[model samples]
Target: MEALNLLESFVRSAEAGSFSAAARRLGITPAAVSKNVARLESQLGVRLFQRSTRQVTLTDSGEQFFQQVSGPFSTLRDAFASASQDAGKPAGVLKVSLALAFGREYLVPLLGEFLARYPAIVPDWHFENRPVDLIQDGFDAAIGGGIELTEGVVARELVNTHIIVTASPAYMKGRPVPAHPDDLAVLDGIVRRSGPTGRLRAYTLRNQAGDEAQVAQCTRMVFDDPEAMAHAAMLGYGVALLPTTHAAKWLESGALMRLLPGWHADNGPVSVYYPSKKLLPPKTRVFIDFVVDAFRDREFAARFGAP
Candidate 1:
């Protein structure tokens, strides 16, 4: 077990490029992680890493050792974990990446209930607007829309991400209400630039009656984040296209009103993504199940689709 711990600390540190980050993933102190690596190096009589203030780089011998040991070590760990999980509770640091606004509003609120249900698992969640490389970043899971479906990763969709045109009541107070999708062209538009592409997003609105209209709003404000766009709309900046997940609370609070209510854009579904591992970790599996069940119980699928 001690040798396994030492190996795990070294592998995690190599993957993370920093002792502190490896410690966070291992649920240990940085000093402990460093000591483990040092111990491993002493046993092998090889200097494994070149350490600096900000990060660590693997030495040539260390890289070779890592390549030799990592795969076998992972298989061993998974086998042991599978046996343990059959008899014991799921326990470990469960790291997840989440979309910023939606995660804060929807997922973060479920933390209390989740922790109560699985007290042995520690949540280390990162909230960001961009899609993350789950394998490279060492995340157990991620939740968002439009994430690239990379090889070895699978996405279980939670909700249909629908976008609706919205504006604050104050913004529309003296303005002509858009009776059709074409009417949105003359309104002040709070536009969004694609974070990954660095280009303006062109939305094509659709109605239930099988009509499609390319939305070309008069650009007034530009933003890269949905949360920022929602905030700007609430502050009466302009009409904006928002996903129901981001606009739900504001719309409920009367801070924003849906415009062209019958028209919407269907982006891809917001999904919970995880690696397609044969022996998925117990903690990751449980978290995915919990999120799915929570969505079902809360009717989040229905709520995030139309509102």
Candidate 2:
């Protein structure tokens, strides 16, 4: 329908940040894209964007509407793309970004099987330690721990990840292992500097009454890399807070011992996020579904030693 076309055009314009860019991508004139978006605004009874000669930005209402409509629109697009596939083959470039450590430990191994299954799909993988802007950077998808999705992105929770306090056997040799969170203040601790904030590592601990209390202030060494922190902890640096997934193999090998087991912080979930598009390419949909199925299997917990 014309309304649907207008909606698609508006979304593309907003994403591209310019009618000219949208026009080129859509294979239409810039004026046509502008008119289509104007028609969309009229029908919606709200000005979705504020435009000037220099820039185009979404209005507050536009941002809200985009968040609600983007996912459904992307789903509908994926459905259409799935129906239109020829010879039962999916073809397209799937650009994905992921954190370095998580990507190396989990996604890299999983991607080999994925690539083998979808030979027609070309995947471009970017591994970084920091978050990248999905729309601005032109990434189709991302796999990361945090769910800090932008306005026009959709996130699917894949797994629940927990943080554990850990230290090497040498570090625990002389000192009594911390039995509770509050006891951490007296023990040596290695801090991660690149977390949500560049501050001391604070963890959730339980008090004597079995209620949760926050232990916000005890640190001896700070490191930017979590792997470094783990290594430092292994060398008897101090207790380090790490994701359970990252520390699982080390724990199993007796290289690292979990400290204050009852006081570990429960981080919400790990998710795959992608920009909302009118038609999600078949490859992206299949990959997302595959990730969901792979993570939700009961054996996944046993394999990862998730608690």
Candidate 3:
């Protein structure tokens, strides 16, 4: 068992590139990981890593050894985990990355019920507006749109989010409502700037007839966050393009009105992502099923569709 522990520590540190990152994935302290690797090196009578202040690089011998052991080690670990879960309740820290506004508005509300059902599982959730590397970052799962489906990862789509044009009633009070997509060009546009790229987000609204119109809104204001853009539109800053998930509440409350209802941009599918493991950990499996079921039960796919 101790030998297996040493191998686990070495393999994880080698894959993660540093003791600190390996510690995060293993849910242990960096000192413990470093100590285990040192012990392994002592037993094998070989230096496995070239350590520096910033990172650790595998030695030639270590790289060869890693290639030999990693595949089998992972399979053995999965088998053990599967056996343990079959004999016990699903338990462990479930680390997830979530889109900030979408998580707060929709997913976070389901936490209480999730926790009540799986009391043994602890939730470690990070909310941000960015794509994450699920395997490298050691997350159990991630939820949002526009995330790359990297190798060894799979996505279960939740909804096809539609980006619709919207604005406050006050903003359109004296101005004429847009009768067509081209009319949005003359309106004061509260636009979104891409967080990953500095360029402004371009919108091309399409209707059921397969007709498309590129939105050339006069940029009156800009923001990187969708929630901020929605708030700005609610304050009557200008006409804004927003995903239905972001605008749904205000639209229901009459704070914002849909403009040129026939036209909308397809924002693509919002999905829950996880590693393509043959034997998924029980904690991750349950969390994925829970979220997928909730979305289906609530009919979020229908709710977040084009108007």
Candidate 4:
């Protein structure tokens, strides 16, 4: 049990990046965290971290050790959490991170139902448009589009997403609708700046002959925020490219019209991801199950349409 405690302390401290931060998270003293890590290192005869006045960094040996131990530790943590489920209702905080627009437009409503179903569990949620390191941040789970899974994390597909090109009816009122991808050269184009690389992406449209071709050069407006780009498109500022899920309401309302509908690319998948473990906590398990069910429901499919 002492060994288990030390291992848990060491893992949490490594993940959190600081003894003080880990101690606060574990409801223990910084000295206790430091002592446990020291004892763990002594037991293994290996130094885990190089400590400094401002920060702590893992040694090469420590990184290899952590990779080996993290999997089993996750399993043990999950098994322990699962065992506690039979004692009573799940009662703890669940930390989650998600895309801001998706969280506000879809997940927020979904969570309302989840909260009602499990009142004993509390959630601490963070929404952002940028990528985050879930393990480093101590997040239990994350819901996102295009999340790349790495070692120590498990990713489950929740839904398929489609990309769509659209323009406002106002913009179409005077301008000739683009009959081909090449026609976009004369029309105003709105582009999204890639979050990771900050590069502008332009879509290629397919011809009736099924030959792929790039859109022609046009006056381009770039925006980092998807919501802002969509709004600008709605105001007839330019042609906007966005996920089908985000543009669904506007398409239904006839405020925006899909352009080159047959040429859009599939945006891959939206998924819920968490640390890979042998057994998930009851609350987290229930949440994952709920999201899967919600996405699979026929009614839900009707709203988002076929991917």
Candidate 1 weakest lDDT stretch, 10 residues: 79-88
Shift of residue 216 alpha carbon in model 4, Å:
3.1
Position 101, candidate 1: lDDT? 82
Please give, for residues 177-234, the per-residue lDDT of candidate 1 as tens digits.
Answer: 9999899888999999997788999999988898999998899989998889999999
Residue 215 of model 1, lDDT score? 93
lDDT of 1: 0.89
**Top-lDDT structure, candidate number:** 3
1-307: candidate 3 lDDT, tens digit per residue: 6987899999989988999999988889999999999999999999999999888999999999899998788778767765676347788789999999999999999999999999988999999989999988889899999889888899999989999999999999999989899999899999999988899999889988889999999999889988999999999999999999999889989999999997999899999999888888889899999999999999998888885
lDDT of 2 at 263: 59
lDDT of 2 by residue, 1-307 (tens): 5766787778777778888877765678989999998888898899999999865789999889888886676576567667767676886778889878877887777877888888888888899877777776667789887747778789998777777788999989989877667777888878877565776655675433568867654679888777788788888988888877778778888999987765556756778898777677778888888787877863445544333
Considering every candidate listed, which one attains the maximal TM-score?
3
TM-score of candidate 4 versus the correct structure, residues matched by position = 0.84
- Inter-residue clash pairs, candidate 3: none
Clashes of each: 0, 0, 0, 0
List per-prediction Cα lDDT, in the order shown. Answer: 0.89, 0.77, 0.91, 0.79
Off by over 4 Å in 4: 1-6, 20-32, 35-48, 58-72, 86-88, 206-209, 298-307
Of 1 and 3, the candidate ranking higher by TM-score:
3
> Per-residue CA lDDT of candidate 4, range 1-307, in tens?
6988899888888887788888876779988999999999999999999887756778999889989997788788777777776465765788889899888888888877888888877988999976666677677889987666777788888777766678999998888887777787888888887878888866665444667877654657889887888889999998887877778878889988888767665666778888766676888887888888887873544555432
Which segments of model 1 are wrong by more than 4 Å?
Answer: 13-68, 81-87
Give all candidate RMSDs, comma-separated. Answer: 3.2, 6.1, 1.5, 3.3
C-alpha displacement of 277 in model 1, angstroms? 2.2
